[model samples]
Target: MKIPILIVMLLLLTSATSKKMWKTRYFTKHVVQQQDTWCVHACMEMSFGIPQCMALHRWLEYSQQLIFPTLNCCDLITPDNYCNCVEHGGVARSEISSFLRQQFSPISGVFTDLWDFLPRGDIVQLAFLSVRYTSTYHLVVLREVEQVEDYLWDILYCDPEVGYSTRVYNPNKLEIIY
Candidate 1:
């Protein structure tokens, strides 16, 4: 009887220790609790064009899940509040602030999720769909997110015949993968 009791107590102690260890590991780490691809897809659509954003926003709103929201390019701008161009100039602090003011507007706080250069490339995938060559810069949109790490991640998209791209952002200009 004494030996059996000892074995039960040891087993219970081991189980409790393991459970506590797991709880610590899970809670202490900054793990992303949820990942909604529709959010990602809608973001990509915003990157692609204004027409698409409008259309997708309507669709998401009409759809059942209601998990994501529609975006407005004009909301990304100020004074006009409907312009689709962020790169009217380069990203300066003042420009970004103006953009943010528009973004955080009390009526509609859209574009809040828009990322600056440093944190922009969070969850995108580049499939190298096609490339465009402008007089000044080249552009590409990859297909899928290639890697995700604690610090950063990569999306595999097409660009102007260049190698892999690490995106850079500024308040004055908004660069999209598509």
Candidate 2:
């Protein structure tokens, strides 16, 4: 009887402790955008820890119903080709925010000043003007912010355009929409 009781107590303790450990072990995976226009989808995947294809499929479904009534689901197999079927080849900020709120939890307010409002290690979708293209906007995932000095800070992000993670110092024209 004592042996069985001891075994039950040990099993209960292990299960209880394992739950706490599992929560702390949660981490986001770095997902690269499969296509040029899938940057926002990739950011969503990284932030929510979902697959990029899943994000695209869900967003496409959502947008088709409300925003793009005439939109057709063409070439479902190829995401890159499917992106071209959209009007702008990308989604607007308002649409992205609305989708996020309805699909996931509500995000914080839009912050133009990254250093002032954003906290460290907070994953956020960032919008900025394209450096290579003229008057074009691009989206990336802001993975982390590390303060380098009193006024200087390093911004780490996953750039879907380049399909990798890169760091920049004091990026300009940054728009954070939750």
Residue pairs in candidate 2 whose N, alpha carbon or C atoms collide under 3 angstroms: none
Best by lDDT: 2
Model 2: how far is 124 from its true place, Å? 8.4
List TM-score per model, in order: 0.20, 0.60
lDDT of each: 0.30, 0.55
The per-prediction tally of clashing pairs is 23, 0
lDDT of 2 by residue, 143-164 (tens): 5565554456576666666767
Tell me the tens digit of each residue's lDDT in model 1 across 72-148.
53355455453323322222222333332332222111222213322433322221222223433322333333223
- C-alpha lDDT (0 to 100) for residue 175 of candidate 2: 57
Query: Which residue runs of candidate 2 sit more than 4 Å off their true CA positions?
Result: 1-27, 66-75, 79-89, 109-111, 119-133, 171-173
